[model samples]
Target chain A: MKRNPAALFFVAAVVAAMLFVGFHSARRAGSGNSDSLDVTGKPAPDFTLDSLDGKKIQLSSYKGQAVLLNFWATWCGPCKIEMPWFVDLQKEYGPQGLQIVGVAMDDASKDEIAKFVKEMGVNYTILLGKEAVGQEYGGVNVLPTTFFIDRDGKIVAREFGLQSRSLFVDNIKKSLSQGRAVQAQK
Target chain B: MQLMPRSKSQLAGVLLLFAASALAQSPGKKSPSVTLAPIDPVSVTRGKGAEVSLHFRVAAGFHINSNTPKSEFLIPTALKMDAPTDVALTKTSYPAGKDMTFPFAPDEPLNVYTGDFTISMMVRPLHTVQPGKYAVHGDLKYQACDNAACYPPKHLPVEFEVKVLKNATPAGRNPAQSPHAHR
Candidate 1:
């Protein structure tokens, strides 16, 4: 066998770099609250947050229905793109036990958020978000992070950033199909 | 020599591996970011004002709202300076924001700044201020977005050094002694 020390050394260096990258990627994917974090098929973390109308709203209260928990901010432009779609979808799917809840993750005042919601004509429930609550779901580092929860309260899927309206419809359908059908409470 | 082709092939293999590694590691493209350029040292005579311009650059494929956005709901990019007692930022002039339509709101034009932009500020040191170098610090608050998504508002720390020169002639200079100069 011909001894090629340079070639062997180069191959070893490349392999080491590849291993390092793989390890780094795995660590990143396990920690962040965005696309890297995989919370699918896991129980949705429940929390109590203040609704827009000075009332305490709890996530677990809406049981036996498919839930779309959206983390959005008033300053998020892409989030605005999805707002009307959400309103329409809520009207279309409300009878089918689908509930869309928007968690306003912003530093804006409650009144400001409510005003924006009113201007957008949002029909869904909006809850003021806290950093601790965001931490529970890994960390809402990105705007418009959405979780699709089934009737069993398991997160069917998680989407980060603005996605197409059709994609949202598909996830909603999947979520509604798995959860038990129960009459929605006002 | 027979080994020349072999050496070239080996080099090509290494280059390909490095290029592939870079491609896999580049994820910042998805994130929006803005950066401030290092400010040039500004020298102002005590009791006089000097114009200092701050240059900021936005990452490719991103834009930040101007000081006056069309919508009140939007967070405008603004600079807030905290200067020493001796120093004051009297005025900050923002460049007029260009009206641009994005895929998100195509019908409604929004005022925004993209790529390189500058914010000019007037820096003045009181006449009583000692002639020396002072660091003026501030923060730039901006909300950035791309064609598809928007990021939360971020504050970038900004700083610049101002050299205050003596407003009057040095006392060391012997005044031309006119016999009745004071009279």
Candidate 2:
């Protein structure tokens, strides 16, 4: 039996179309993975705001130290739950050059936030952030977006929701170790 | 393009392939569903304060954090009240929400709402108040997500009517009186 050239052409066309579709979808998936907020090896965004107290806190001011910048609001539930862990993290790492900064995105008055902060016994620096500033850093599209910045100001990791204490610690350790390795190389 | 017709089997084969692809990308495929609950109406006596709660119901496997959301990318719920100048608006407190992590996106975790949540606000009357049904509107913006993907920011408008009594003291206080005043 003789082979039909037209049938062979049709088969080849179908094969090529399927391969193209598969390749395109895979490429899209890969790009999405890399586009999360500058999680690793990028300079953290700098911000300055007054704490619940009258004092001022600046992200860049904490040079030579690792900083955990946590964006939250008084009305967020998970934020309240994470407050104690944040305080604990500060106590455990403050001496080791770790700064934990809390930025509040509340629509309520500052006094209301202060009351909540006082009730929670939050000792870290708390700053007030507007929606514009929140959008500048990405914005509180969701609650409890946490960024881990290293001593060199590079954002090492980021968590968009309520993050576990262990996950936070592990990421910080990894970033610190990486920093040391880079220093040794230098 | 050809006047020559193919066999019935060939047409069926082509139709079958198209059907398979359609099934793969069909809307009925496993997707997380989200729904919002209406805000309840609250009433207060004259010259007094009335507290009412805003409700949100999230589907399973999806959750949103309370007001103090962690990331700028995360959706933070908000309440906007439309009231007369005579009505005082107090701050609302959100109950603590669950800490939710998108399992597939192991790197980024957002504190979000998964199930039902509420926001309670204290509405007060001014010294000189009128009697009527005042509407309190709340725009709760939130980003919902399941284990794999996050939905776009949802603006849920929750409104309730509260009756103000005669000779009632306005319950809403001046936002300037608080430290976290947004105005």
Candidate 3:
């Protein structure tokens, strides 16, 4: 088959242009969707908000322990599904310096949030999330946005939406392995 | 130079492929949306009540809670309208929700609406209302969710026109009384 040189060159150029467009479009989409993942291996944002018990809870206070900071809302059903897993993980890893923290990002009343937490039998800390706090950690576009922070307060890994329990366990183990643990206060 | 028919056809095919590729990558990045269908102009006689139906479409791959969600935590879809003083919004009827379970919670069934749904409301005009076209503006508040995740509550603006006829509709008209019955 005799292929015209001009036609062949034109087709190749067109293909190259299309590939460039696709690549750049994908990169932009990736950055927007992976805002939380971009913070991996970086210091987790520290925030202080009132817990269900009315006491101010500071993120940096748990610096000595590995932290699993989760941003969730009352309306998020997926968040509800992961609650039991988080509860079980807390019990399994608490003695090993793993501290899980939940931040409620809904506009519900404090009492209502407290009630939900109690009903879930969540053993870890539950804090009322504020817009300012959420903005510090990529604006939390998805519910159940979880970040695994090492004992040194740096985020080792993060997950969006609902993921397998095994993934959570893996991140927890990785978080616990890194960073030095500080002595507990008397 | 004018392109041959074969070259032109080839170019068109290439453009179509590009469009398809662009659309394929947008769903993940684009936010979910619920759009209101354009409503036809409605005519109602003064002093008479009229039923208005509003049609809404949820984006594909997403569902919104029904007017009555099973859980208190879920934000149910609701319509709030500010009818003109002369015209009152009497009643709102919501469609029954579909009981479907999502992968996130297989055991618990949620009351949700997907695809196209209609919300009907009653608009009653007072007897004193003058004949004119009135714009009824409102908003439909809903929280959307997909199989994997849920989005926060959003309010989509709702608007429709109601033309009130100048002639008043007679109320409580009894069928003509028979004169023979009186005898």
How much of the true A–B contact set does each candidate keep? 0.31, 0.00, 0.36
Estimate, for each residue in B1-183, the C-alpha lDDT of model 1 and write its tens digit: 577578669767876876566444443224567899989889988887889999999887789999999888889999999998888898899999999998878888889999999999989999999999999998999998777667778999999999999955456655667334577
Q: In order, what DockQ does each candidate have?
A: 0.23, 0.05, 0.28
Model 2, C-alpha of A112: deviation from truth (Å)? 1.2
Docking class of 3: acceptable
lDDT, candidate 3, residue A74? Answer: 88
lDDT of 3 by residue, A1-186 (tens): 344578768767776776677667666643213333368878988888998888999899997889999888889888898999999999999999899999999989998888888888999999999988877887777677889999999999877777789999999999988886643332
Evaluation by lDDT, superior candidate among 1 and 2:
1
Task: For candidate 1, report its TM-score.
Answer: 0.81
Ranking by lDDT: 1, 3, 2
lDDT of 3: 0.83
Best by DockQ: 3
C-alpha RMSD over true interface residues, each candidate: 6.4, 8.7, 5.0
Q: Interface RMSD for candidate number 3?
A: 5.0
Choose the strongest candidate by TM-score.
3
Tell me how far the alpha carbon of residue B150 in candidate 1 is from the true structure, in angstroms, after superposition. 1.3
Model 3: how far residue B157 lies from native, Å: 1.1
lDDT of each: 0.83, 0.65, 0.83
